[model samples]
Target chain A: MTAGIGAAIVILALPAATAALLSVLPSYRLSAAINVASAFVTLLAAVSLLAAAPQPNAYILVDDLNVVFIVLNTFVGFTASVFSATYIAHEIESGRLTPTHLRFYHAMYQFLLLSMNLALIANNIGLMWVAIELATLTTVLMVGLYRTQEAIEAAWKYFILGSVGIALALFGTILVYMAARPVVGEGVQGMLWTSLIAHVPAFDPALLNLAFVFLLLGYGTKVGLAPLHAWLPDAHAEGPTPISAVLSGLLLNVALYAVLRFKLLLDANAFALAPGPLMATLGLISVVFAAFMLYRRRDVKRMFAYSSIEHMGVIVFAFGIGGPLANFAALLHMAMHSLTKSAIFYTVGQVAQVKGTQQIADIRGLTVTHPLLGWSLVFGVFAIVGLPPMGVFMSEFLIVSSTYERAPWLALLLGFGLLVALGALVLRLQGMAFGAPIGSRAPAKASALPIVAHFALVLIAGVYLPPPIVTWFQHVAQLLR
Target chain B: MKGLDFDVAHLLAGGLVLISFMLLYQNRLYALLNVFALQAVVLSLSVAWQAYVQDANHLYVTAAIAFAFKAVIIPLALHRIIAELGIQRDVENVVGVGPTMLAGLALVALSEVVMLRIASEADVLAQEDLAFALSVVLLGMLMMVVRRNAVSMVVGFMSLENGLILAAAGAKGMPLVVEISVAFSVLVALVVIGVFLFRISERFETVDAHALDRFRGDQR
Candidate 1:
């Protein structure tokens, strides 16, 4: 167990450390190759974590919850690095990015991934908050990397909103400490999740209730839940597409993971208020709001960006329902959403580069232009829109059924929003992939391997459940309840 | 909980909330900067008070940061940015001064009632600190919403963060990392704004946010 954790740290640190070394290595290609190598090594470590049984009381353990998340985060992160290696090469060729900025980007990418892994693996709430903020700061800096007017503006907006959200979260953390102080006594012991959970009911109810509110709002913003989600679309639309993939697929899930940890705390406290309804309300609002907003998007990346918000909303809402049926769906949906959204961004990155614009109207008939990328986009959009035989569809169906059994009206709204979003998505997909090919044929030498690999996973997930994954999610869901 | 004694931290935190109201009162851009600087100094003092009261050395680091970064660097940077941007003539407001003050008063009252109700059973100090923190936060947000000038909005945000620093100190023995990050964030933000403001001035004669909209329109 100790060996596994040591390996995890090495996996995370190696890339960042290597990038630091790579920065001074005269050739940019060599540095990019090293970055990709480090990402693969991290992915290897995360995969190996699944085989290593966790030891109790360990600071970092590959448990049921984080095992899936870490693997998913690293896997997507690897693909992103691969794509970025090539993408940055092009930017350097075009004189858009200097070698110095490439070094910064590569280093920050690893740092961001490390922080994400730390957040997902953390055993303590305080540690989790710090890790997530580290992740946020790294991403904020990266988002502003272009140094253009819009890029800076987007980064500034993200920074301000991210800071405010984090401040609210710290207040919630303080409140949690206050609540636990009497029950667990003040000091390091009170901050640990396992310790807090065991003694939760003994903690003050009012403090727990209030703390949960702050926790929900704070982390909910990171999850890109509506009303508090202003910074998200801009961040996604403006940043490099690989970073967009990480932000949408991994970072949002990590934030929700933190919120789930606190929800478990609140759930353990018998007298404390239920977190279910508040989460449900916010989740539904985010879904409906994003769904309607999706139709009017003139910018392609921004359109999918809103779609990320909508899909995350669906996953959180499913979890908020908090039953075996819905929780199971939520977990599966999270996995599929990460894979598909990252894949979509990968495809989008290729398209945007080929056409040199984020404007949807500028790029036309992807299927004729680049069949590999076009089909990937089609499959990605289909998967994201919750079509049949994709794992997302399975999860969304299960969530609807669960809602139907409990609150029929909410199910209707969920269905309504999903359908509206689906309609807009299909419309745009056809517009981009089925129409006449008007753009230049400058073919991309992009790797189709990642897109194919993700589709295969989503495909397998829809048809069958690997027993270990299903069992793991069920256990975590029961813990949530 | 009932037996716990709190004297100076309590008074200082309350004083910080009272000064937050000055945000609504100050109309001139330079005066608003002065008020913000004062608020940061007060925030630093409160953190220092907590360090003495709670016997934690880490919070003293928070105090030094609050004083050094917020009180000095941010205001000085903002002062220069405003001067360079040529928007230092007077502050503009989307809403009138009177209604904004009235809204600010109502916000304070709402904070008191809400905080008192939520924290009714907690120790008196926490209840008071939470109430004051909420007021400062809400007032900061309120200032941002009401003011049209970008500089004032920045002032309002700095004031809000000053409140956050106070709340962190009040929590007592909370990690030094978050406090340090908060201070570092203020510094990072100052650099970004400094750059953005200079660019704004170079692009357009005025730093009025409305001018930014017009700049966009012209580009489009």
Candidate 2:
């Protein structure tokens, strides 16, 4: 228990310390290195936490559920930092970003990591809301880092939508506290997750139902579910590519984590409305909507942003199904999507730099011009689209097959969405990976280490059944009930 | 739970909802800002009254934040921004005043129905407060949708936040940690929106959201 607390403290403290240090450090290279180093140390702490016993308190909780998230969050945080180090250097060379912008960028990156870690670890629902709000604010600032007409516009749109969503979330949280007040008796005890979960069955069902609606719509906006995802593509396309990667990879998952926590709260109440159907319906809408939308994205980043919505849709649907196999599959799919999607963004970042345009019409024939980057992208696209022998395929297969056993009709609807999305991804992949080399053939200077490392891990996960990891996910799946 | 305490809280919260309707009815940015500031002031009073009734001293800090930042500082800064930018013109409306007011009235009814039905077991004070807070929040959203001006949208967002703070303060024995964080988030949100308004005006020469649509990446 003591070790777990120590590791958790280090996980949070490293980022806080680095954010302060990077703000004043004028040297771009040094700040970037420190950013990467801090993330690496945080990841190490998160890994050590996996072995610790569950610790629950008023403010912090370290358990199987959040341990999984913290590990993934920090792993992606570390790799994204490495990718950003090289990616930002190119932006500086091309004069798109100034040194001062890079300084702010590095500091905000650490702050984003800090806030997300805090959000995941917070046992108090109110503290979680505040941390999530801080994460949103930092990302809003970073999204506008370029300060282009579009960047500013995207940031503004994201800020308004994200803030309103968060406000509603806070209202829901307050409602939750109100629901608990009578049962738990008021004070800080009513706001603690450990206390609430233990007492939820005795709370008012109507209040729990109402709170779920608000929490779903509120955090669903951040999850980029359909109807609330307006700011997502714009934010992704206009921001720096590294920020795009983290936004897609980590932030979306963190928001989904928040939603799942509340879903658990609702599930614990015997008379409360089942949260599954609502989540399933929304997840299905996001999947089908994003699938069709993906076909028309003229920009590469925006297309992948749509892809993220689709994957999140699938994961949410799996969780909505809410059985052991489905929960495990959801967990597996989330991890795979984080690795594969960020790898795609990492490749896309370099590809955009080399071609000098994000417009699909301008860049073509990646295989002919840049084979190393091109092939890595091909692998990433295939992985993301859920081709066989990749981890995503394994998880998607489990989700579909399990859904088929439970509700074949819903499975069919899900299958159709997945197929539509698959078609769109394959079509885009064909255009970019083959055919006449269309744009400028500048030499790519970005490192391939992050992409290679992610793909290797994903490939191993797909083909092998690492017993300990399987046990870990199964334990988490059992707890989800 | 006493008569006087509940009545005061109800009156202030209902006044907030009324000002939210006024916010939606405005066809000019200055009028809208003034109405929003009015809502913020009413919100602070509502929060302060809740503090006194609940005997929770921490809520006074939340009330002070709303009064100082939302009511006074933000509106004055926005007023100066408008003067400097020379954009003190009539705000563009997506829907006419009659229709907007009608929609706002409908939203209030909907919120009251929802909150009152669901929270039947809770105390009368909290039940009425939740209903009024939801109305204010929904009306603030309506205001955001009804106006196309960037500055008005910011005002709409902050007013929506005022509704949230009211809800937080109304919940008895809620800790100070959440209240302070709520206040902090509001400040950060205003600063971010303030920065963006300047950047938007500088780049496009207008604060109209329509100016941004031309740059959408997905549009062909």
Could you tell me every candidate's TM-score relative to the true structure?
0.93, 0.97
Which residue window of length 10 is worst by lDDT in model 2 chain A?
Answer: A50-59
Give per-residue CA lDDT, model 1, range A1-481, as digits (tens). 7767666676567766875776567677887788789889889988888777456363554567777788888889898888788777887776667888887888788888888988888777777887887888889888888777767767767876787787678778877877777677666677777788789989889888988998999988899999999899878888888899889989999999889889888888788988988888899998999999988787788888899899888888888888988988888889899988888888888888888777777778889988888888899999999898988889899999999999999999999999999999989899888788877678874666777888888988988979987888898777667
Identify the leading candidate in terms of lDDT.
2
lDDT for A379 (candidate 2): 94
Q: Each prediction's DockQ?
A: 0.32, 0.61
Model 1, DockQ value? 0.32
Reference-based lDDT, residue B192, model 1:
42
lDDT of 2 by residue, B1-220 (tens): 6888878898999899888877887777788788878888898898889888988888888888788887888888888777777764688787889988999899999999999999998888888889998998898899888777777777777777777788778888887544554556565555535554654443233566555444666444
What RMSD does each model have against the real structure? 3.1, 2.1
- Candidate 2 lDDT by residue in tens digits, A120-155: 999999888888988998998899898787888788
lDDT of every predicted structure (CA atoms):
0.80, 0.87
| TM-score of candidate 1 on Cα atoms, chains taken together | 0.93
* Residues B121-146 of candidate 1: C-alpha lDDT, one tens digit per residue: 66677778888888898898888778
